[model samples]
Target: MSLSRTAMLLALVLSGAQAGQTVVAIRGEDFLINGKPTLEGRTWRKHDVEGLLPNSRMVQGIFDDLNPETARQWAYPDTGTWDAERNTREFVAAMKAWREHGLLAFTLNLQGGSPQGYSKNQPWHNSAFDESGVLREAYLVRLKAILDEADRLGMAVILGYFYFGQDEHLKDEAAVIHATDAATDWIVKRGYRHVLVEINNECDVRYDHAILKPERVHELIDRVKRRSAEAGVPLLASTSYGGGSLPGPKVVKAADFLLLHGNGVKGPEAIRSMVERTRKMEGYRGQPIVFNEDDHFDFEMENNHFTAATAAGASWGYFDFRMKDEGFAEGFQSVPVDWSISSERKKGFFRLLAEMSGEGK
Candidate 1:
């Protein structure tokens, strides 16, 4: 076959692969892309990530609105009706812009949790799964659009399957399992390469459902892995802890990768200590470590969250929640996300990421 035809055929084969399939692999301590080392010469405890250090964010509310009560919802005015074309276009544009600035991954939640407490009457139950345990078609379409765009932009997505607050919307643990199976099967069928699975966001949070609680969280992680295996997809899976707490030994052993949060950590030394401490655990085997959610905003400080994480040889993610201020843009976390790099926090993060990843040049 001609080179063009050969490339086209290879693409078709890849596009048809199962979800959770081995799109990204761990090769001796480095993450491998198409059998080649990525994030060259950088390794945490002698193991390097296959691709770029994922400069990720918890952008759960980007595609959907946060407040269901208001007529003019956060993301778009028409909350009930899904605008496939406009939604995809804006999401793709945002992903492209972030990628150009060296952001390689994002942490998106299927069921987003509210940072504000439940008593505040927050609409924290916005979820992709309905009560009947079916993944919403509209949500799936939006997810596919983002994943497709991420693949095209050479970026990855850390897709969170459940959130504690909204998980109650499901009837029971079996329904949760059914939802998991269905979602994973769909992902497998779609054959997305640049995606990772986070079984639950902050598993330590107080979940109404017993199955999703902290003590039994590893079971769900295992369940996701089993679903992937059964579907012939190689899914990398992990669950996160709440702010200031390290994952227990069970989670550490169960997860394919270690995810740590630095929200309440005081300084860079504390961050370094956490990473070092995790490495010293008994079952620890030098899996790739990432600080996937940290809300510390000491951007100009010397020992800020970003500097602390990178210095300790771990990948980092930014988590900033912002309420709508009259003069400010909504790119930062919280509701009504601008989706553009409008806030100083977003700009500074991308700038620093570009500089660190050598994409700035």
Candidate 2:
């Protein structure tokens, strides 16, 4: 029996080496499984870059490409606003469906906020907690529910706790820490074990969004890492961004793994340019890297980007929100989802991606 066990173990080790797979796979980006580094051939998916942007109307307006000046002219559905329960059910179903296609949804926060304009997503308050405390409370309650379901489904939810671009979602030092701690606790309890803890979606501040002092980002990363550890989940700290706070130490210095939001930068070449710059950097060289957001609109685009990111020694994923049946790549304006299919675009993109990366197969 001992001989058998030894031989079996030796065979396993030999096969792993023969196949070119590393010994310990990256839980997220520690050591990717697919002969890739950081987050090779993996796409950090998020359908709506502005999922937590603001309100339905504004979201629709943008989808319609309505100019801010004429934003009011564009009327959203009479069935306005995303209700928590309904959104949860819908998201849960969407993720299940996406699994069939090999794709997964981001966290509910990607869609977190309110009609007053999703928590902190409101333009008027950018980062102020309401004196009434209504929005924030409602948000946490709903968010808690969403995380619960995601865990049940074993879905990978990327919690964007920092200031992406929704200035309204901005938090002062105290609030930021409080919120981060809260989110970590909630996710842990629910068992959603986040695939990644992405701080500040895609923060792009205009004025030296650069804080000479970057203690806050570092602090946020450490707290979440600790909280996630307590929950028994292998936590990976990352920041998703493209501009504004470009080169901010928040990303340059503070994350466990590195991520880039090359939203409009399609094709392998464009992505390569950015990947090269980062991999060659001082802090980025050895750490893992991922492309959490590349909304080029469909599986084909995801394939293009994932291939590029991986070749560059990074992992990547395409974004997918809405009911899986809604359609792929945000569903062009004219071909909007009927909201009934519940899993249309889910099939192609994820399946193709998983297959290409050798996961689906």
Q: How much lDDT does each candidate structure score? A: 0.67, 0.43
TM of each candidate vs. truth: 0.83, 0.60
**Model 1: ten consecutive residues of lowest lDDT:** 9-18
Off by over 4 Å in 1: 1-22, 42-52, 61-88, 115-121, 323-328
Cα lDDT tens digits, model 2, 24-89, are 124433443223332233333422111111001111111211124433422334454322234333
Best by TM-score: 1
Q: Write the per-residue lDDT of candidate 1 for residues 313-348, one digit (tens) a residue.
A: 677888766644433254445544446788787777
Best by lDDT: 1
Worst 10 residues of 2 by lDDT: 50-59
Error of 1 at 350 (Å): 0.9
